[model samples]
Target: MISEFTRTAVPQLVGHELEFSKSQHEEKFHSLHEAESVIREELEELEEQAEVCRKLFEDLHSDTRQDDKDGAVINAKYLAGSAEYAAYEAIQLAAMCLKLVEMAGREDEV
Candidate 1:
């Protein structure tokens, strides 16, 4: 009698376990997809900012007058300083992303 009851209950328990596993898998995929989408968007925005920084640096250097040595030198220094700050910020952002990737890899290993 006990053996018969165990055989009958085991199949139902297995079926429920399979359903729970499938649901968990689906949820994990959805979360991964969302995270990828967000990372892609952030990369696009960073690329745009990088372009702007490049252009600003180029324009500043090109606009510097060889004839007006004093004023041009001052202006160039100011523009270059601004460009340096922007580049530093971009570097910081890249570092943050790198740290995040490293953390995710560690989590996966666990």
Candidate 2:
């Protein structure tokens, strides 16, 4: 009962189990691609934030003259690292969403 679209779209995520986003392409991306666009924008913003975190980290690490405030600097650096990691995870989520969009697009083309 598995159709070709499902077979193609879900293999990477579902393997050879022959599953699709829906029973039909019409059911596939009704709201899924919209979610993708939103997530992609969010991810891009996160990446930008991560870059800012990296810059802040450098500021915290440099300038030995600020040794008296090293604890504050260290805390800032750690917070930055956490933000960067969160951003990377968001980026990964965006990538996955994009993949779904591409799959949906391909289904549409068909």
List TM-scores for all candidates, in order. 0.42, 0.41
- Summed backbone clashes in each candidate are 0, 0
Per-residue lDDT tens digits of candidate 1, residues 34-102?
556644665666677666666655655665634556655665676676666555444434443443454
The numbered model that scores best in lDDT is 2
Relative to the true structure, candidate 1 reaches a TM of 0.42
Top-TM-score candidate index:
1
Q: Which stretches of candidate 1 lie over 4 Å from their true place?
A: 1-66
Question: Residue 65, candidate 1: how far off, in angstroms?
Answer: 4.6
**lDDT tens digits, residue span 4-43, model 2:** 9856654444321113323323333446766667567767
Candidate 2: regions farther than 4 A off: 1-28, 31-36, 63-69, 76-84, 91-95, 98-102, 105-110
The alpha-carbon RMSD values of the candidates against the true structure, listed in the order shown, are 21.9, 10.7
Q: Candidate 2 — which pairs collide? A: none
The per-residue C-alpha lDDT of model 2 at residue 62 equals 63
